[model samples]
Target chain A: MRKTAEQTAEQTPGHDAPRPVRATQMVLRDTPLPPGARWRRFAVKLVALALIWGVLTEFRLDALYFGVPAILLGAALVFVMPVAPGWRISPAGAVNFALWFAVQSVRGAVDVAQRAFSPAMPLRPGFRSYAPDLPGGAPRVMFLNTITLLPGTLSAEVAGDEVIVHMLDTRADLEADLGALEARIAALFGLNVKSRGST
Target chain B: MPDLITFISAALIAAGAVFFIAGTVGLLRFPDTYCRLHALTKADGLGLALIALGIALTASSFGEVFRIALIWFFVAVASATGGHLIATHARRVDRAEGKEGS
Candidate 1:
């Protein structure tokens, strides 16, 4: 990671000094949750675990007692992981995200399918680095995850704010697609993105 | 009506099969690891989702449909995360070998 980070830093024109990649990006590291939110997340997670229990047990009511302690333990484990700070998801934005995600997944699949079946196998795959405007942590992670599912793009690595992506077709405007997806993700997280036009 | 439902489910399942086949072919034939990862992730993700949808359509109860949806959701998450990890690892290996710019 350090080596790649150095490579990434060197590849960029302005980044002369090699900095620790993901030094500030904490993935389950150190974001203290409020008491109320903590409890709420615990309860919600417990219920989710319970639902999984129900499914696995075929909704047998008798299994609830056995699953209770496990559920509680599982829910408690969530608090230990580093979480995004003050992360709040808008319900409508989430719905939009889901819809867009589904559509994009199909598009990605169809695009690959077409390319895979083509006789010429016209593929000009390459890598490009993108600096997203969203704040570090979950938002960026989510963006990278989404890129993998989107058509013609895969996030090869994420170091600090710079995401190195591999594109299936170099001719395609990947930065534009990343920008659009980043905006959607920002809206979903309700993050106030700075320098809207520059991205 | 039941026949129509069966026909739709069958079509969806067949379509899912086609996507899966494409994904496997891409996995085998693609030039590089990153490109193959693209093929595998995208095709398998959609193929599994479509298969799940077909199963949901044919499910006898709402609970069964919900279960199928849950399975599909998990598959989607796993594929996305797994694909990212593989691609990142591949990139790291490539850079380590001093074979940059692919």
Candidate 2:
């Protein structure tokens, strides 16, 4: 039976989630080198990461002193690391979060500096909770921390993925921004949500 | 060449700090809840990223730098996740109080 829209919104991610898995099935499945595949991928990723670090840090591979450690360390992690199969190398959420981070860091710096030496500083403070228009769990946690990072907001507490934030001023503006946030997050998640409360 | 990188990293770090300052200042100054959130989340992820990148400049080895960079990446992800969750909660609160929404 298809669940109604309202029912889905209230559902949280957990063992009882719709996509429950069977332990026995996983164990019996003829997944060849399942563990081996995971290890190989992990090792390859670390090696690639070392190369990237080399470029960013401008470290010459020929430099034995530092270069060798980088290779050895990376390889060691790949070979000996204890990562589970369900874990992902690059989750979609992380990628989207990066986008927000780059844009906000620059904005925060500029905003804070201007207020510091300015002749007049306009400020407001209040406590309020918002029913966000995004998915629960990970996205919700990000929202709370992000609130803390801005000029005058703090995430107080979260219950069932709903966020409570403190704002110095501009609640309406923040509200709109949150609306836009929902849209952006939706895009990042590839979720084709038509309206709020769609999960 | 290393010196050049150091200088750039310093500049970036300084820049990120400026954003953090502004974010806090905005938090102190903004007139309303919605606006305050706007002030913070945008700056939060980016500022943290720049600061992390700046520190990674002096990493002892490539792997160290890579690890540092990865941490920065995590902060960025955390910012967005935090933003959305809080927004959702805010909406619910507003509704309870019979308030208009954005």
Candidate 3:
């Protein structure tokens, strides 16, 4: 099922890449969650949910009556659900990415604000397709989300390996920006960075 | 110290409001849907971050601060996702109308 869908996606013409329908199919076809990982996820989620409940209820002891069962149910749902492959986040890389994202978000906002306030409204908007080196999963989704927060780029669609980006200014060097972001994301996810070929 | 904190918080929040105004203006004035998505996502993301930081500073308890941070995190995710969805829909509509890369 997955093989045929991917082949069809690849064969489709460039101008009209079909909307991605693989996520639900993947969920259906996914292997059973490993016992160790399942327990680990349950434990972590239980603790996190407990903490959130404590905060929400201001840590009243009486609230435990409701919170305990609710939290247990919520965390146990993880066991029954198909686990999407998890990304192993690097702590140092996450800190670095967060700092970079914060700075770039400010720059992105300023860039748009300037254009918005300008009398001439200088915008050279166009779509450019990029083939990401990152695999089709969490890393690619993160990269796409990050593009919207970066300076002058918004991800319009993702058809297979190709992501169509809408640029506020077509003159900007998009390859450099996207490449830098992909590298940062790769580091964060502890994945090997691959050099992207020319699109 | 409290006075200084208050002043800083007020300043940050005011700065955030300015960005929100800029974002709204861009949404109104931009020539097309894609450009407007750029304006909405970037400006509003930063604007909310600044505002949330300012509010976190003023929060009375650590729990309150954590809650504020969580709110900011969820908003950031939602805004990014929403922007992408809107852009995808607009692109599809345009493509259907035989407009490519406007």
For model 2, residues B2-102, the per-residue Cα lDDT tens digits are 99999989998997787777667766765555555655665545567777878888678877777787777776666556665565556556654668643
| Structure candidate 3, residue pairs in collision | none
Q: What is the interface RMSD of candidate 1, in Å?
A: 4.9
**Cα lDDT of model 3 by residue, A71-141, tens digit:** 99999998687566565789999999999998999999999999999999999999888878875557877
Residue A93 of model 3: what lDDT? Answer: 90
Structural similarity to truth (TM-score) of each candidate: 0.86, 0.48, 0.87
lDDT of 1 by residue, A84-126 (tens): 5556788888999989998998999999999999989879999
lDDT of 3 at B62: 89
User: Which residue segments of model 1 deviate by more than 4 Å?
Assistant: A1-32, A35-37, A55-59
Order the candidates by DockQ, highest first: 3, 1, 2
| Model 3 lDDT per residue over B7-99, tens place | 999999999999999999999999999999998999988899999989988999988998999999999999999999898888767866768
Best of the two (1, 2) by DockQ? 1
Stretches of candidate 2 off by over 4 Å are A1-97, A150-152, A159-162, A196-199, B1-3, B16-48, B58-60, B70-102
Model 3 clash count equals 0
